[model samples]
Target: MKLARDTWLIFQRQFLLLIRNPIWIFVGVFQPVMYLLLFAPLLKPALNAPTQAEAYRIFVPGLLVLLAIFGGLFQGFGLIAELRAGVIERSRVTPVSRLALLLGRSLRDVVSLIAQAIIITLLALAFGLTVFIGDLLLAYLMLALIALMTSAVSYGIALRVKSEDALAPLMNTIAQPVLLLSGILLPLTFAPSWLRHVADWNPFSWAVDGTRALFAGDLGNDRVWQGLTIVAVLTAAAVWWAAREFARSVR
Candidate 1:
C-alpha cells in the first residue's frame, strides 16, 4: 500500500514534468512516421505479400518495436541529467522509497512510448495498414513491457556510468547489435540460414516476430505467447535489479 501511494505521487511529479515538455513526443514520433510514409512504400514491391496492406503488416510491427527500442534505451539520459543537477542526490535525502523513484520514472517512459505508438499506429492506418483492435492493443502491451525492462536497465547503467560521454558510445554500441540481430526493419525469415540461426538467439527477435504475428492478425500464434512471457520475466528481473541499485545508491 505504501509503495503504491509513493509510486503514484512520484509518478504524478514525473508525468507533470513530461507534460510541460511535449517536444519529446514529437521527436520520437517523427522517425516512425517517416518509415510509414517513405520507407514502407519501398518495401511494398518486395514484400511478397498479396496486397499493400499485407506489406504494412510486416513493416509496421518493426517500426513499433524500433520506436520502443530507441525510446526506452535512451531513458537513462534523463536520470544522468538529474544526477548532475543533484536532483537524484537530493531525492536520496527524501522519504521517497528508492523503488518508487525507479517505478515512477519508468511509468512516465511507458506513457511516452504509448503515446508515440498511438501516433505511429494512426499514421500506419493512414498509409494502408490494417489492424485488429485487440491484437493491436496486445502489441502495445508488449511494447510497454519492453519499455519497462529497457528503462530499468537504462537507469541502472546511468547510475553506474554517470557520464553521458561514456554512456552514449556504450549504448550506441549495444543498440546496433541488438537492432541487427532483432531484424527490426526486415524479417529474418528470408535471411541466410546462418543469419537466421543467429537471430534465433536474440530474445528481441521473438518479440519482433510476435508483434509481427499480432500485426498480421494471428492472435493465437505461439510466438505471441513466447514474446509476452519473455518480456514479462525480463521486466520483473530488471525492476528488481534497478530497484536494488537505486536503494544501494541512496544508502
Candidate 2:
C-alpha cells in the first residue's frame, strides 16, 4: 500500500512536470509525423512487397510503434536532468520506496508514449488506413508494452550515465541501430541476406512485427503472447539493472 501510494505521488509529480513542458510532447508527435509524411513516401519505391499498398500497410504500424519506443526511451533524459538537479538525491532521503520511485518514473514515460501512439493512430486513420476496434486495442496494448520496455531500458541508461550529454549520444546510438535492424522502416525481406539474419534476432523486430500484424488484422493471440513475453523479460532485466545501478549511486 505504501509503495503504491508513493509510486502514485511520484507519478503525479512527473506528470505535472511533463504538462508544464509541452515541447517534449510536440517533438514526440512531430518526429513521427515527419517519418510518416516524408520518409514513408520516399522509401515507398524501394519496398519490394507484392503490392505498394501492402508494403505501406505492413510498414506503417512498425514505424508508429517505433516512434512510441523512441519517445519513451529518449525521455529518460528528463529523469537524468532531474537527478542532476538534485531532485533524485532529495528523493533518496525521503521515505519513498526505491522501487516506487523507479516505477513512477517509468510509468510516466509509458503514459506519454502511449499518448503518442494514439495520436499517430489517429493520423493514420486520417490517411485512409482502416483499423478495427479490436485491432486498434491490441496495437495500443502492444505499444504500451513497448513503451514500458523502453522506459525500463532508458531508466537503466539514465541511472548509469547521469549526464544529459552522455544520454543523448547513447539514445541516438541505440535508436538508430534498433530502428535500422528492426525493419521498422523497411521489410527484412528487402535487406541483404546477412542483415536479414540480424533483423530476425532483434527484439525490436518482434515488436514491429507484432504491431504490423495488429494493424493488418492478422494478429493472433499466440503472437501477441510471445511478444509480451519477450517484452516482460526485457523489462525485468532492465529494471533489475537500473535498481542495482541506483543502489550503487545512493551508497
Candidate 3:
C-alpha cells in the first residue's frame, strides 16, 4: 500500500509535466506517423494481403512494436536531463520508495506510449485498416509491457552512464540491431533459415510476431500467448533490476 501510494504521487508529478508540455507528446509520435503515411505505401510488393487494408493489418503491428521499442529506449534521455538539473538529487532526500521513483517515471512512459499508439491506431483506421477491438486491446497490452521493460532498462542505463553523449551512441548501437533482429518491418519468414534462428533468440521478435497474429485477428493463436509470456517475464526482470539500480543511486 505504501509503495502504491508513493508510486501514484510520483506518477502524478510526472503526468503533470506531460500535461504542461503537450508538444513533447507530439514530437514523440511524429516519426511513427510519418512511417504510416510515407513508408506504409511502399510495402505493396512485399505484403501478401488481399487488399490495402489487409496490408495495413500486417504493417501496423510492426510499426507499433517499432514505436514501443524505440520510444521506451529513448526515455532515459529525459531522466538524464533531470539528473543534470539536480531534480533527481532533490528526490534522493525524499522519503519516497526508490522503486516507486523509477516505476513512477515508467508508468508515465507507459501512458505516453499508449497515447501515441491510439493516435497511430486512429491514423491506421483512417487509412482503411480494420482491427477487432479485443485484438487491439491485446496489442496495447503488449505495448505497455514493452514500454515497461524498455523504460526500466533505459533508466538503469541512464543512471550508470549519466551522460547523454555516451548514452546516445550506446543506445543507437544497441537499438538498431535489436530493431533489425526483431523484424518489425516484416515477418522473419522472409529471412533465411540461419538468420531466422538468430531472430528467434530475440525476445522482441516474439513480441513482434505475437502482435502480427493479433493484428491479423487471430486472438486464439499460440503466438499471442508465447509473446505475452516472454514480454511479461522480461518486464518483471527489468523492473526488478531498475528498482535495484534506483535504490543504490539514491543511497
Candidate 4:
C-alpha cells in the first residue's frame, strides 16, 4: 500500500511535467511517421508483399518495436540531466520508496511510447493495414513490456555513468547490435540460413515475429507467447536491477 501510494504520487508529479512540455510526444513520433510516409512504400516491392496494406501490416509492428527499443534505450539521457541538476539528489531526502521512484519514472516513459505507437497504428490504418482490436491491444501490451524493460535498464545505466558522453556511445553500441539482430525493417526469414540462426538468439527477434503474427491475426502463434514470456522475465529483471540502483543512489 505504501509503495503503491508513493508510486502514484511520483507518477502524478512526473506526468504533470510531461503535460507541460508535450512537444516531445510529437517529436518522438516524427521519425516513424516519416518512415511510414516515405520509406514504407518501397517495402511493397522489396518484400514482395501483395499490396500496400500487406506491406504495412508487416512493417508497422516492427516499427512499433523499433520505437520502443530506441525510445526506451535513449531515456537515460533524461536521468543524466536530472542527476546533474540535482533532481535525483533532492529526492534522496524524501520518504519515497526507492522502487516507487524507478517505477514512477519508467511508467511515464512507457505511457509516452504507447501514445506514439497508437499514432503510428492509426496512420498505418490509413495505409490499409488491418488488424483485430483484441490482437492490437495485446501487441500494445507487448510494446509496454519492452518499454518498461528498456527504461529500467536505461535508468540503471544513467545512474552508473552519470555522464552524457559515456551514456550516448554506450547506448548506441548496444542499440546497433540489438537493432540489427531484431530484424525490425524486414523479417529475418529473408536472411541467409546462418543469419537466421543468429537472430534466433535475439529475444527482440522473437518479439518482432510475434507482433507480425498478431497483426496477421494469429493469436495462438507460439512466437506470441514466447515473446511475451521472454519480455516479461526481462522486464522483471531490469526493474529489480534498476530499483537496486535507485536505492543505492538515493538512500
The best candidate by lDDT is: 4
Ranked by lDDT from best down, the candidates are 4, 3, 1, 2
CA lDDT scores, all candidates in order: 0.90, 0.77, 0.91, 0.95
Query: lDDT of candidate 1 vs native?
Result: 0.90
Residue pairs with clashing backbones, model 3: none
Worst-scoring 10-residue span by lDDT in model 4? 10-19
Tens-digit lDDT track of model 2 for 25-123 = 778889778877777665546765455456567767887778777877886787787787888788767777777777787788878877777787777
Residue 43 local lDDT, model 3:
76
TM-score of each: 0.98, 0.90, 0.98, 0.99
Candidate that scores best on TM-score: 4
lDDT of 1 by residue, 29-135 (tens): 99889888888887867877778888888988988898898788899999999989988888877898899999999999999999999998888897688889999
lDDT, residue 155, model 4: 96
For model 2, state the Cα shift of residue 183 in Å.
Answer: 0.2
Residues 205-228, candidate 4: write the lDDT tens digits.
999999999999999999999999
Cα lDDT of candidate 3 equals: 0.91
Better of 2 and 3 by TM-score: 3
Candidate 3 accuracy as TM-score: 0.98
Q: Per-residue lDDT for 1-251 in model 3, tens only?
A: 98999999999999999999989889989999998998888776667667788878888998999989888999999999998998888877899999999889999999999999999999999999988999999999999999999999999999999999989998899898899998788878888999999998899999998998998889888989999999999999999999998988887
Write down the RMSD of all candidates, one decimal each. 0.9, 2.2, 1.0, 0.7
Per-residue lDDT, model 4, residue 17, is 89
